[model samples]
Target: MKNCTLDLLGIKDSRLQFDPKYKNKVTTDDFYNHRKARFIHLLQSYPCFCPVCGKKMKRNGFKTVEMVGLPSGGLTNIFSIRKQKYLCPSSAACPKTITKLAEVQDVKANARISQAVKYQAVSKLGQNISQKYIATDFCISSMTVMRFAQGVSTYLKPNQHYLPQNIAFDDFKSGNFSQSGMSIIVMDIATHRTLDIVRSRQNTYLRSYFLQYDRQARWAVQTVTVDLYSPYRAFIHDVFPNALIIADRFHVITQAYRALNQVRIQAMKQAGHGSHNSRALKHYWKLLTKDSAHLDFKHYHKSRNFRNLQLCEQDIVERLLAMSADLRLAYNYYQTLLQAVHQGNPALLEELTQSAAGLPDPVKKTNRTLRKHRQEIKNSFETTFSNGPIEGTNNKIKTIKKTAYGFRNFENFRLRILVELKNSYVSLNFHSA
Candidate 1:
């Protein structure tokens, strides 16, 4: 019976014996008003010597400690253990009578919750679920769950002495937890592991933060992939002198993509509202932006906007481009820019951006923006690194905030992200108190 009880509770300590008086009795408690499986145990372990005098100690009766444990069989389990008390005899070395109570294994002294329950709480915190749900599941307060988070965060802290050779920089909306309403995420490009999260994305803050690492570690960084943010480029130059900046290809292509769409919208306006040509411009805008090489010129289908005329994807795009001269110019430049990026040809990109005359204002503006970051854009073509992984991380951060409805404290928010993202692993032996 004792072995079965010990096995049921997952207790490994042999000194804790189950009391037979309350056998087979599970009751509800008035305090929690929930079904609870209660058990009485006696701690039979005793210390041979007193700590202060190093002399034999005598038993001083027993003291019962009530402890909350992990749920079992859909009911909260509470252990009422009678701890054997010890008393040191008065002597010259130790004049006063000192008493100590035996402590249960896998539980802290004077703590009401068992270490196993805290370990379970820590594991649950690694998931995307919020603290309120975890607290309700474990029948504990949200503050206790936060304490568990704080405990696990100690092991998740990034090492200040190390920096990867290739890193990616990006920022995400961190709510009001940060001073700037944004936070920076530094990621390792090779492993896709998040290196750290900075509370603020300000230049001075980032400069001081990266300067904490050793100069050799900083110098070892070979390349940095970042968005088209100009301040980021300047910051990289000041901190990582040897690091080559690679402007993310996605952001670069986005400039051209938006400009082309703007020109298409202009074509729709010029074609007159409620007209078939305007409707065609609006409906077939996707075909205009799609790769010309992918268009199916062989397959013909009846068009809704062209009086039942049979048109293939290629024909539809050509007709749409014929709406205005500016549209045609912008479409040609957009397609060429897409081809250049796909082929990783920096020279074509340079020539295209340098000679952007007679195009729409939007496309011209995109060209100027591309010219400003010409060198970094060139490095992007030469390097295989991009901000794809970091952008995915940002999406995850946004999802986390969405699920939790946002957090009030920045440190807690950061810790929850680090834990959920698997940035660090927690061990059961760690103390949460």
Candidate 2:
């Protein structure tokens, strides 16, 4: 029974002695609205000699302390321990007296919480829940829960000595965390682990931040995948001299996707409001934006937009395209770009971008963007890397923010994200320190 009680409480200190009549007693905790298990024990280990004078010490008295322990069998465990106190041997020549209390390794000095409980609390912080929820679980205040998390975060700091060979960069809405309201998220492409989250994505801030790493670390990065954010390209080139900046394929495709949609909207407007053509354009927007190759030509159905005309997806799209000459031109460009990207054909994309004349203004702008980052876009097609992992990490950050309703303190927010996402940094026994 004694061994079981020690195991349940995670008490490894051999000096601590359990009471003869000690038993796991469960009682109702009205304040916390839960059941608690109370155990009584005594810590009577005495110091053999005083550190100050190297003389024998004498026992003074026992100091009673109440410490919260890990929950067992759905009940909160509390330890009432009597710690032995000692006084150093007094001498006329030494003229100094020291008093000390025997301490347990599992619990910190003057703290009412055991290290085991703190470890559990820190582990719970990694989950997608608010600190208040963790507080309720441990029957402690929310402030205490935050302190436990902060303590673990001290050891979870990112290792700035090394950087990954392939990395991806992106930003998310920081929501009052930074002055710019946006923060950069760096991720390792190989491991798909979030490397770190910088407080700002501004050019100067990014340059200074990456410069903290040694020249070798910066030069080791080979490829950096990013969206169409103009500042990011400049920042990458300046900091990582050898890294090839790969434009995100999704963003590149989105540029053409958006332009094509704009052309369709214009076509709808030219068709006039409340007209059959305009209504058809509005209704079949998905078909217009969908990849032309995926349209089902075999599946035939009656269409309500064309007097119940017998038509398939291909037939409907072809008929819609015939409504406006500008729509046909934009659709052809978008479909060509989409195919080029999907097929990983950079030559076709280059050809289309080079000769995009007579295209609408929106498409022409997209063509210019493609021309500007032509090499990066080609690198994107050649490499298997993308910003997909960082995008997923951003989604997790959003979930963390939403679960907490929002974070007023950016450090706490960042720590929570790192604790949750960067598992390599957090350890199971971090709180033992």
Candidate 3:
């Protein structure tokens, strides 16, 4: 029976069976060395051919190199490698000699960490995790982790994809540093992806970027939405003549609300020192611009004295709040006007003109701006285009800022944004399946 079992085990070949320990003895070090040898063999299979001559390289020899690895708490694996060098037949023309062995998996030729480790490092970039913590976890030096991060960054730079049919532009102040704090973000509105970010929103910078695109690429853009910034208006008109420029609804409302706030503040300042009225005005300040019907009865009671202030301040504040309701009504009417225009109703123009007349002074100004750019605004409504994606991306930028204690270098900040966007695109594609 034992003979039969042995025969069965050796069915493929008539080899004799032996005790597992006696058959082959291998240590942990031996296995590690074998693994390293296999990795080197795999690399050799894809020879680092000479760029000039395209010839297979020969191993020159081994070189002892010291490189930073994981932090003190982690073990650093320092090992020697066989270097390769290729000799070109034409010594005079070929600047060829012995080539150093290819460092398998390592991002930098002589670096201690591998490309896999570098990629892992990039994944943690901009995360709140400290360099020291990463070093300890990976058993490499902090400097090594940093170098790996830099290597990953270099590899990703060339592969960045920035293709978009429609893009939106907007700017936000970095902080209280006046224009110094302002940075502009250009985004692909359709895909909700950021296209580019610049330190300034100046026309000259935008013009250069616009001109970088060929005529065909420039013409591909159907429309662009931005705020009432005159610089953007001039630049888009000059660069993308075929593209329509629509003022975003959010920008329009933001501007209107800003103006309303200005009026409110001015009115409060002019109200002078009437304790009762000033207190009342202060109490109902937020409620003033909100829908009156949405306000609780207590707010109305608190603000009753504000209604008794001098005619101009009272009238303006009341009028401003009234216009909130009018704005809503106008917004609905505008939607109808949009539908009518799209349907090519003959009386649509007349209806829009009438609607314009019904708007309050502030709203009338906004409508006039729309009318002057009527074709663009109308096209915007007709198409499913908006800067909503860009707005959403802005929140992401803020998150990145918060995650990292705050980036001092705009270049690094921009690169981090690009990396995050690429990662997000990859993640979305993966999850969508």
Alpha-carbon TM-score of each model against the true structure: 0.92, 0.90, 0.58
Q: What is the lDDT of residue 308 in candidate 2?
A: 94
**Cα deviation of 113, candidate 3, in Å:** 2.0
Q: Order of all candidates by lDDT, from best down to worst?
A: 2, 1, 3
State the local distance difference test value for candidate 1: 0.81
Give the alpha carbon lDDT tens digit for every residue of 111-140 in model 1: 988888888887887678888887776778
Give lDDT for model 3.
Answer: 0.53
Candidate 1 colliding pairs: none
TM-score of candidate 3 against the unseen true structure? 0.58
Backbone collision tally, model 3: 14
Instruction: Say which prediction, candidate 1 or candidate 2, comes out ahead on lDDT.
Output: 2
Residue-by-residue lDDT tens digits, candidate 2, 1-433 = 8677676568888766674434633344433555455554545465667777777778888787878777776667777777778897568635777888888887777888888878788788878879988887887888888887887665666666788999888999998767789998888887787777889988999999999998889999998999988878777888899998999999998999899899999998899999999999999889988999999999899999989989999999999999999899999999998998999998898889997779999999999999999889899888899988888888988999999898888888888888887433344335346
Write model 3 residue lDDT over 69-141, tens digit each, in one string: 2222123332223333444444554665534444443446655554455556656654656565665555556
Q: How accurate locally is residue 336 in candidate 3, as Cα lDDT from 0 to 100?
A: 49
* Candidate 3 off by > 4 Å: 1-108, 126-163, 174-180, 291-380, 402-408, 422-433
Better of 2 and 3 by lDDT: 2
Candidate 2 clashing pairs? none
